[model samples]
Target: MATNSIKQPLWAVVLLLPTLSSCGSMAAWWTDIGPSFVLQNASTGLLTHSLCHSNNTPLYPTDPPVAFKTKYAPKNGTSLTATGWYDTMTTWASLFYQNNNDDIVNAVYKCNFETGTYEEIESDVISDRSGTPPPNAQTGLSVALLGQQEGYRVFYHDRARALHTLKFTQVENWSYGNPISTSTNRSGLALGSMFSGVRNVTVVTPKDVANIETIRLNIDNAWHITTFPTPLRGSNVTNLSNLTSLPYDTSSPPPFSLQGWDGNPKAIGIAIDTVLTRHIFYIGTDKAVHSYAAFVTGLTESGFRAQPDQSNEYWPLADEPNSDFAIASHLGSSTIRLYYLSGGQLIEAKYKNGNWDPASRLVVANTTVFTNNTGPVEEDNGLSTGAKAGIGVGVTVGALLLITGGVAAWILRKKKSTTSDVEAHGDEGASTTAGGAMGATQPASTAQSPDVASQHAEIARTGSGLSTEKWDTDVKDMALTPPPRELESPNLASELPQGIDRNELPTKHHITELP
Candidate 1:
């Protein structure tokens, strides 16, 4: 009877076909319904709106009010507790802050110069225990966006008053390795009042490569610079063991030391020029903006030259008590911008074409407009929101298609051995053809100019723009001599060591007049 029933229907089977087809169609439509809604919501949410559309007012509706007031805002009073950098690749401003609670937070925001609108894509706390327990006011934060891997590296002082660094890649969350202990006891150095008081931190990667270097004042009351090669390639962690300290004359004697000026809690700024020259700006105890330059020649006697004597002029806010400064440089450009707080307003100066334009004092933002308290901020002349939305949609669709196609291919291979065999054979021929084509298209080596060749060789030998071989040699030579005893007072301005002449110290350069 069952066999007869199965045979009964050419007509019946034909009639049932429409219903089965309809069911399949309904299933497909049902599967697509959820995604359709998601796409709609995502598109609408990402649509760009102008914050300054109505008037030429600031982007934030209320001054210093939390929701979307530039890249960062201080929760408390007018001390700028935030710093930001512009990412050219992403066209977004990445901001980091030490909030009122002493927690570290970072956010990425896009600005629309056309519409004057600001949009935040992501914001989250970087560290909950960012040296808040005792509330160290001098514990500033520094962030460097590594162009090689499109990731961020952060440096800060922890609650234990230790110097620590952490990294964040697009694929993974923030991960930190062992903190570099800056304790005088651990380092066998005398760091007086600057213990755990981090005035500033700056990081740079020369030639846009993996060789990362950082300069900061540790608990030892001295500015120390360290370099790490391939900093992003390790077991998802920074290897501090490879850290090599650079030379800075912060010894105990009056002639060698800047008399602990490097340890000041005011502010310090570092920038790399187009030719890989490093410029360090700091506020000296004399209330002057002191500047120093390090040429990329091998790290020998002439590695870094101090122009302290040249920096005699005072900056607008540089001499003000409790004032801090920040610096930013355009990638692949000779222009460097300096920012500082003056009368609760953010001001800027530009260093371009071999001169610092102090008269280019542009008012970046008024702290009173957003809040009464001062906040450190960074700006970007970014793209429109509509452009960003288009990019976001395209990326989302591409990802979905890739995932769906991969799943379909996997399922088909699992269901049919014949299909797998056919694909394997095709892949083998394709791979062989690709290899032969690649070999055939290989170009002959082009000879580089003598100047270019020499530059490349130097980069290879030193693993950086600055050669460390001679510097290492100098260190080894110094190690042969007996170490100096710890100074009774970290500040020994009154007591001058014999046979040392302070007049012969490296001269400074005017901050705004630096070449």
Candidate 2:
């Protein structure tokens, strides 16, 4: 009778594997979602990463993710942005973040696609070729790689309330652009940027807190700015803070449950797809993801005004997010991924195959990558909202382990013995970033130190060191838009389908946009 009691649980465990495997297709998750995302450890405030690998799925909590401390620890609610080059032949990634002192720090890493690992190359303050770095940045900052010798640009808001740019190349080094004059003061510190072909576009919310200011670097190598009105500044919408604003009652959809905008950091997530359609994402007053798509016209002031397609339905899954978020799209790919931190959990949403997937996952936020954030992880460095969330998760996990621990232990022993170290010994070195779209990779150690080029060479190499003719509308011969196009779905509606959980309470908006 004793032997049978012990054996029964093991049989149940064997049966549960297939059920968990099919619950959500592991293959489908990777194909539709993405490869990885970057995060700031809420516990330690250091940079950490969460990724998907062939050998592992969310089903297994056995082998935890390894986190290497990447020196830049962002402020409590700072924005995080990344840009890099990735293709079959090359991969390089760079992460730009605002540190505690409000300085813009750059961390470059060499990535192995085969083993899903990041090897640090260099970490330092961004400076010009003259070895002069730019001014300290406020919370809102963004970066982009503008192809070849055109180099990369990091745009940030300064304490003086001015928008500034740091443009750099491998040979010419770094130089500061004149402070950009805005149509209005940036009442909301929301800023985001994307680069493609011959144009780079950045958008910020001016003092009005309602309209969007589009800043463009045209084919002529000059900056042109335009402001567009959005439905954001509705009568009920007011600048408040998450702490004070009326929490949104997400028991049902809007009209029935929409709340006003509180003082939440409007961290913008932006990406460009293969169709020349540029999309921007931000947290609405209701704390859901509101999306707008436009076909780039390549003109100066009205560059993004033409063919604007706004989605009527907001992605409700993106509720109550922290100020930092990201959007990433692969080179010439139709898929775009959105990521944000909510209650210390990293939520991922996807817009692909001409529709937004109503399904979003609480990704690595639940995994061991967040070991510190997954419990009452009080650390000396600092832990805020994310750490508190772990108390509940810790209790539930403990209850579950008490029931299955013996069965799990025996099974784990059997599984571990059969699982051998058979991953490829060597692979090409590329790039790593938390917020940008990255190429597919295999599992590898995060400890390897790969050979890297000189600092200048890294700047050029990270962006593929290939520059085409500058985008000139007058240049009839240059190909600015790629030829591939998606057949427009005439039946497509402007709204996204809602994904709701009846048991959970919804967030109310009370956030004020911080400059």
Q: Rate the local accuracy (lDDT) of all candidates.
A: 0.30, 0.39
Tens digits of per-residue lDDT for model 2 on 173-278? 5566544432224555666776544344444433334345556554344555544433322223222211112223234332211123333345665666655466
* Candidate 1 local lDDT, 261-343, one digit each (tens): 42433444566544445666544445455555655443221233455443212245443532344444432234454444343
Candidate 1: misplaced stretches above 4 Å?
Answer: 1-74, 77-90, 128-138, 148-150, 184-262, 298-304, 308-314, 317-319, 341-346, 364-515
Compute the lDDT of residue 143 as modeled in candidate 1: 52
TM-score of 1: 0.43
Say what the RMSD of model 1 is: 25.9
| lDDT comparing candidate 1 with the true structure | 0.30
